[model samples]
Target chain A: MHAIQQQYWAVRDYLSPVLKESKFKEHGRITPEEFVAAGDFLTYKFPVWTWEKGDPSKARDYLPADKQYLVTRGVPCLRRATSLAYTDADEDAERLLSFGDGSAAGGEAEDWVETHAGRQSNADSAANPGSIDDIPDLDGDGAHEDEGLSSAVGNLSLSGAKVPDTPHLDDIPDMEEDLEDDDDAAAAPSKAAPSSNTVIDGSEIEVANGNLLQVRTYDVMITYDKYYQTPRTWLLGYDENRTPLIPAQIFQDVSADHAFKTVTIETFPHSGTLQAASVHPCKHASVMKKLIERMNAGVVEEQKAQRKSGSKDAKKKWMFRRASGNGKDDKPLPDDEDVEGMRVDFYLVVFLKFIASIVPTIEVDSTTAF
Target chain B: MPVVQFTQFSSLVQPTFWHELTRLKLEVLKLSDASVPLTAHYSAGRTIKDRNTGQEVALGCNFTVGSESFDEKHSLPPFAVVAKGIVKNYNTIDEFKNADKRALFSQAADEIWDSIEKDHDASALNRFLLITFADLKKYKYYYWFAFPALVAHPLWDIEDDWKEAKEQFTDKQLLSLHGHLEASTTPYFLVRPAVAGDGVDIAPVEDYTSFFANVPTDSQTIGFFDPSPHPSSPGWPLRNLLAYLRAVHPTTTSTLRVLCWRDTEPAHESGQWKSRFGVLTGGPAEGKPSAVGWEKNPQGKLGARAADLAPMMDPTRLADQAV
Candidate 1:
């Protein structure tokens, strides 16, 4: 049913006249020029991300020289997504899942978040359960109310269990053992195997407390996807020992909801023969549009509340003035508030927020405020 | 006192390196198996722990090379030791497997030794050889990297427990030494306290004879751009430098103070000092030191590593796999 609606939307979008004014507002899509502009804004504001020249042979003319794509290296992935699911931080999980349904804009989103964190992992909402919540967004709230996603959350855990059944993780135990043997064999090429490294490797990783201190790092790259007209994110993960992670090991770090479905191994467009797991951008624009709409709705609500209370705080007034400011020469600030303010420069920032939901374990968004 | 064991250098070949190798093979190196000079760099290491035993594991230090390595005049980042490398690309996988790896390693080792003995080029100590078989049709590359370091006869023993370099020098002095080391193009250098007594005077390794001429035997200090982050051990490059030192200072029986210069940022502000000072005693064999340095594969075997880039390189496979 959701697939049919997706098809319908795709057809409707194709049949409709192309939007001339800020296509990102109507649809999540942007031009390659906007991609470069957004990339510049991202790098300028955050500084964690830098534009890379990449391979000169693969450089696209639309993007500026030395700005073919954006990259932020050595972003720490402290733990795996599986360990994050049944974890502690409730508020962070709530905020992370607020946009889980992709189109949960306005008042309905609040209810979704209130019950979202405790009951389900990201895989639950990211899977078919999203269709249930999405139904209300499309066919109005009251037509077939059905308890409004509280029941959907209960049913999702069963689907969420299916996440562990991915073929990539099935042989993880044996694979890990093989790697352990490799370490031993590599250090002592003889029968004695009495190298100090053997002793060092054994003690520092797992102590009595059982807290694994292996620090897995990732290099995240964002490239403009011309086909999807959205920024595509690629993750190249490293093991605690700084070896490049195989595809199966990399899958363990990605969110189960999108692991094999939305993310796949593809050669980095800007690089030669270097393949990484990249999140598919086909659905990115649609999800981004909803997130923007949600932000605009929240802004409109806050403005209504402020006007009702008649609170003329100077800071609040400054924000209001900027929101509606029609100055002839006043260009919007680089790190200003997002979306409805029509700050298209904040596109990648919002896109990163979307990516954070996918790879929550990787701290790539730490450099950006929001 | 303990026998010193130098940390070996593991090869970290980037996919772009293979891609560049393929391009070089098709365009430039066709029908010729002549060795080509390439560049690799030694960066810092991360200590990985054993999952089952929970003990600390010391991984071999990595020597990373990439597409830019092929550029004749490529410059590495600060504090990274320039790992001079030679690539020997064979035409077939059978030839790669059947080739005499020991003889090949010795050939490279001999050139490095000649540079040390004849030319007194201090940088020759940090050399690596890469043998590869690029199966272009299948997009699979089979390669092995060996960083040859000559083994001293009666192996050098640590004369004392390792101490942080900061303990031996003031912040101002360390900063001055760091400035000198960063400015020097050669990876190896000589250092001693200034005669007038403000800071240390650092000289390139070529001036080792004159630089240590006036200095007393006990105070003679030599430093190298250390790549390994191992608490107790220095990197593989230091092995050859010691061999060179043994040859040059043949008659001396005095203890030598070795400095593992591992600071990338300046010593004053960064606050993260990885440099170490160790006292060593012993020398290489009389005429030539025996050498042994071949990197082990990921599976703990002395074999070439393989990377299949079909999913990345093949257009049809990539399209099929694309979401």
Candidate 2:
């Protein structure tokens, strides 16, 4: 066995006796199965809960051996169960049910263990119950809401039990669908359902009861817009010779004076036991190059139109006054003339640089998920 | 001694005629001495009698140098010795003798030499001789008749001496002379020559004669008749000199002293009888100088009191007081 697994069992073994003694003292009688169950729950919850004395539900004094056993074995088991529920998809459903059971146990065993041990351990039993309650509620929601809540709680619960579940090979397609739906919802809100939103690849095995079961597997599905899929051809050179591959439209308004044109390169995907060579080929570079050329032509055309309009507006301003002359002469004096100077708006340059830097990221498909 | 009696006449004589008569008296004094008392008699001719009354009126007068009494031995020498010296040098006898041959010379000599002697003396004579010769050389053709014939000649030199002596006489004589000719002439005297300084020539005699000729003969002489009795009436030339001195020596009291004048009659009471004359005393003994008072005649008419002469004397000072 691996060291992590051996360490897990050692804690479990040490806690079995304390859980048995605590259950017996608190309920006046307790079976080994109930003791094991309580011990596992406490191990999942570890360090967040401890046994105490004089709990209203318990009848006997808590003993030192029982207290030490609970701390050494039951707390670690409860912590392991919580961490496994977060990171291992196979354990998620079991942990959800166990969390409900743990919340129902209150501090009866903890009180019994502390009284028999003749020690005071006032670990927050109230705080542990709150986390226990949070686990079961997460499962009843839709996949999108559940994933969001899970990720959010995953970060909040830095303790072992609250880690997020890793994607399984069989479950990857569903997760991909959920992520795609979330991205779409975040983006256009009113767009049609995404088409390339699922992944399918996993093996099923028959168990001893002849029930069909799936082995643990992992798959990562990535989705991106046309920009990120074909980024190489979108690599544009700036005045400073810095090349950016992002779609300029992603970062800047196409109608603005400093707007840029863009293209998409290639999309990337990662999966368990899958080599990059097996991935399907796409005309990403050619598409990106064509899109970039088209966008560049459009930008040139817009610039010409802007120049023509600007020159015409300037002519109008020079020939006429904006305000009423109120019967005074509207024309400038014969000797009075304006000399035009060359000017370039630096704000436009800075804005273009910012767009270039960010657009390259949007154009390149460096990650598997959208 | 013979006593000569004569009747007085009613008609007033012209002041020039009186002046000429006095000049004749001085001439007689020059021809005589202290031991001989000089006397003169005048018979009013028909013209004079007709202007007055048809009666024949005769007048006699006598003049002596000093008294024969020892008690008054220190008195001034009689006019005779003084006048003899004057006449010896200034006499027009040669011209009078050859009157027809040199009529212009004789007439010129009489008007120039005689007038100078009657108004100047020895020191003034020397100054006059030197200055007149310079002025003649400077203004030869312009002052043709007067400068050479009267001022530059030897006779004119002596006559200038007597004229100087007359100016040194007491203020009584000076004032009397001023009044004596005030009506028929504007009385003028020769001031000390150096009073005008080295380079300046005496004022032209023609200017004085012309000024005298234009004096209003009908106007009354309204000032003191005795020079010693009061102040000398400053003639136009002396007044002009005093004005120049006042301008140049404004801070000096001695220069200003010559400008003082006194009126015999106070301004409020005198009316037309007022008399105005220059006071020979330096200034008022105490307090501020008071302006001389007299009757003013704008039209040059006798007895016309149209304005007061006090205002004319120093209008600026009166104005200051009024303010």
Per-prediction DockQ: 0.19, 0.00
Q: Over all chains combined, what TM-score does candidate 2 have?
A: 0.13
Candidate 2 lDDT, A1-370, residue by residue in tens: 1234425643653454423232222222223333333333433322222332211222122232222122110000001111112224333233211223232222122222111111111221112211111222344657887787656545433222321211111311111111111111111111112232111111111122243211110111111112222111112111000101012111121111112112111111111111110111143334334434443444444334434444322222111221122223343322323311111111111212332333321211111110
Give per-model TM-scores: 0.66, 0.13
lDDT of 1 by residue, B1-323 (tens): 68776766767666678888998999999979989999888755444332223444544366878788898676454456677779999997667766777688888889889998898877678888998888899777777778887777777878766778887776777787877766754578888887776678988777878888888876778888776657677777888888887786676534678988877556435544668889988853488866777766555555566665554566665444443
Which ranges of candidate 1 are over 4 A from the true structure? A1-51, A62-64, A70-79, A87-204, A207-219, A222-232, A238-246, A280-357, A360-370, B46-60, B180-186, B193-201, B213-220, B251-254, B266-271, B314-320
DockQ of 2: 0.00
Q: What lDDT would candidate 2 get against the real structure?
A: 0.21
Task: Residues B252-317, candidate 2: write the lDDT tens digits.
Answer: 312121211222221222232212222221221222111111111112111111111121112232
Of candidate 2 chain A, the 10-residue stretch with the lowest lDDT total is A72-81
